[model samples]
Target: MIGKRYTVPVITLAATRRDVYGKALAKSRTEGLLPVVVYGRKEQSASYFVALPDFKKVYREAGESSVISLKTPEGALDVLIHETGKDPITGEFIHADFYAVEKGKALRVSAPIVWVGEAPAIKLGGIVVKVLHELEVEAFPQDLPHEISVDLAGLETLESQISVKDLAIPAQVKIIAEPDDIVAAVAVAKEEEEAPVMDISQIEVEKRGKQEEEGAGTPEQGDQTSSP
Candidate 1:
């Protein structure tokens, strides 16, 4: 089910953004609860929380990178991620930030950027500089795409700069970004130094040697390494 694409409903949040809390979110989600805040549609602003399992289903269906529908008990709406918080101690979910979406209206979303072809510069010992990891696009919900990829197989020199206009975008999808936006390019490689790996035995040998030099007895050594 995870491998295949699916569309899951993200229910509108009932409480206002200020009303949401950390502990409440974790408990609600763990007990088959879903929590989200939806505010948009030009004054149709209200937050509603959904079931956790249902929300997980949506995340499973849509790559977290893509937008999904938020079907509310009151009405259905479109929304996307703003942020998701994690627990400090246990590293569990603390909260999620959501923004409402309106179809046919321009919306800004962060979509992934990909590389299409093998880099010619890599073969030439040149470094590839990926300046932008993601792009903020202005388009409708349906128009919003999965990802944008740039080819590097033809790039061999640092003089070339690949722009957004060079991307082979779909006819239905119009990139709201500038055509000259450089997604990635090749650069000259810098010399690097290698560091030695400190093995357990080597570390113990060094420690024992230091201890003896300082008039301390050597450890009865058989490789002092601890197993997890």
Candidate 2:
């Protein structure tokens, strides 16, 4: 399932050129816009603003690997959503960076891994441990895939494992990882250890001893201080 190719619709996002500087960036967000920048191999970087709702929809569909058409005032530019910034507390989009795709050039990006099918080892009381969530790959922007699917059915036994080399990658894409690197593996689940039991009698004895020691240091309740 590694090299498998699937067709994905070309995703497009609308953006407007933004010249806002300094404190104005906050104003853009208040108006339902997100500040973003676009740059490429030999292209000039430019700042722009995109609708928050529209950008969110495109991000969900294109992710980081897939190329999307960014419709700007100048023209439509083919780009990839390279990075994003968010409001830590509110989880709202604050900014984004888009990588303009250069035609005829290969781009190195991380492709997310999608697990397909249920591992047979899981039914046998074995747990599947995923080691890699994404693979670093290089391919032409047009050949880039939204994601790489890894079939879990290959894991039949608890000892079964999948390595980087086991992935069936597309002919155009090259994986930038060690061939022997384990991608996923199945292992026997460990039994939960029992909690240590406390000795109630020993605890009670220590508490009583502490109380008696404190009482010995105090004078009798009826005793009065001797007059000097």
Candidate 3:
């Protein structure tokens, strides 16, 4: 599903001012500014306010792995979305943490899996399941992918499976997950066997027969009273 595209998308967000806290932070959000922090290896952590709309646009595409060009009054910084916080009730974007990454340094990041095409096994009544959804990878900021495409076309039979080794990744990126890790697979659904039905009348007869057998092996009540 992954193919080389000539055009690379440019994601940018402008940071306008310093930290906005308490009532001021709430006021900034009401005014459409999102409070964010940018920091990374060998870089000083700094707080800035970004436009909510602009950040949403970049986040939709860049996610947390892709490099985002953060424009500040000081200069442009290449950063990654380290973490994000959202409102629990409304699910609104509340806060964000961006990591400033060095140009050529390798960093560990998680990339989401994107499934493409339909598995042939699924057409034949086999269930297709994604065993792994995200892949941990080590790569330079520029080499990171927004999402790794996993082609379901490889699953031709019920026993077919896709592993990390089968993924098509760029040479510059290194997958942190084991090569034997399964990405997707197809399995034949087993038909559930119906439980055996019990014969109530036959069970009652058996109970009676057992009672009669025990009674025959025992002495009468009068004979037992004389012995006592």
Candidate 4:
């Protein structure tokens, strides 16, 4: 999925129906368009294409979790950016999948965790360790948050920690992650060990010894003899 929360107004993207079996996919890309599919719980799947630049702008704001309106020839459909495929080499979005949101139905998604504030433990020579980066939650499309904020100020000591239960989530949302799971913690920083120094004199002696051994195995130029 590609969106965050519905903090901003719903974005409207113009879409045109596409031929799924046609050879125009590559041609569409060259024309600055992105191929996409829209499907819903009860709605039949349909293929379409939207302007690449417009889709990129929407993706930046909506991500995979936010709802956006797709204006097609048939009608306008509210959908979420369910998934996307990118070119491995160029990193360009090759295709996208939009999941239509059913009215009054709840959606399950992983909301990103954004760390805010500074941990006091850092002043005490302790480092902060984050365990989880996202939280699994269920909420209506309109109620889904773009991101959940985690306050690092709670970590005052090396032993102090934050868990999923400590998050400040909306009343309309239900957390699916374990309540006891650690989200972030502080730990005492470990000192790096110094690397041992080597003796240059010993290396020179070993090299000389190897040279002598090789020299002893070969016959001198003046000592060459022919066999009968």
lDDT (C-alpha) at residue 172 in model 4: 75
Candidate 1 worst ten-residue window by lDDT: 1-10
- Please tell me which predicted candidate would have the highest lDDT against the true structure: 2
Q: What TM-score, to 2 decimals, does candidate 2 have?
A: 0.77
Query: 1-228 in candidate 3: lDDT tens per residue?
Result: 223433336678899867557777888888888899889887898889998998888898998889898999899999999999998998989899999999878888999999999899988899998998899988777777888889899999988999999888876778897888899998888999999999999999999999999999998665344554
Residue 47 in candidate 1, Cα distance off native in Å: 4.2
Over 4 Å off, model 3: 1-8, 204-228
Better of 3 and 4 by TM-score: 3
Candidate 2 C-alpha error for residue 211, in Å = 28
RMSD of each: 15.8, 6.9, 3.8, 7.5
Cα RMSD of predicted structure 1: 15.8
Q: Give the TM-score of each candidate.
A: 0.61, 0.77, 0.84, 0.76
> Which digits, one per residue and each the tens of the lDDT, describe model 2 over residues 171-221?
778899999999999989789999999999999999999999999999877
lDDT of each: 0.62, 0.90, 0.86, 0.86
**On a 0 to 100 scale, what is the lDDT of residue 110 in model 1?**
70
TM-score of 1: 0.61
Q: Is candidate 2 or candidate 3 better by TM-score?
A: 3
Point out the worst 10-residue segment of candidate 3 by lDDT.
Answer: 1-10
Task: Return the number of clashes found in candidate 2.
Answer: 4
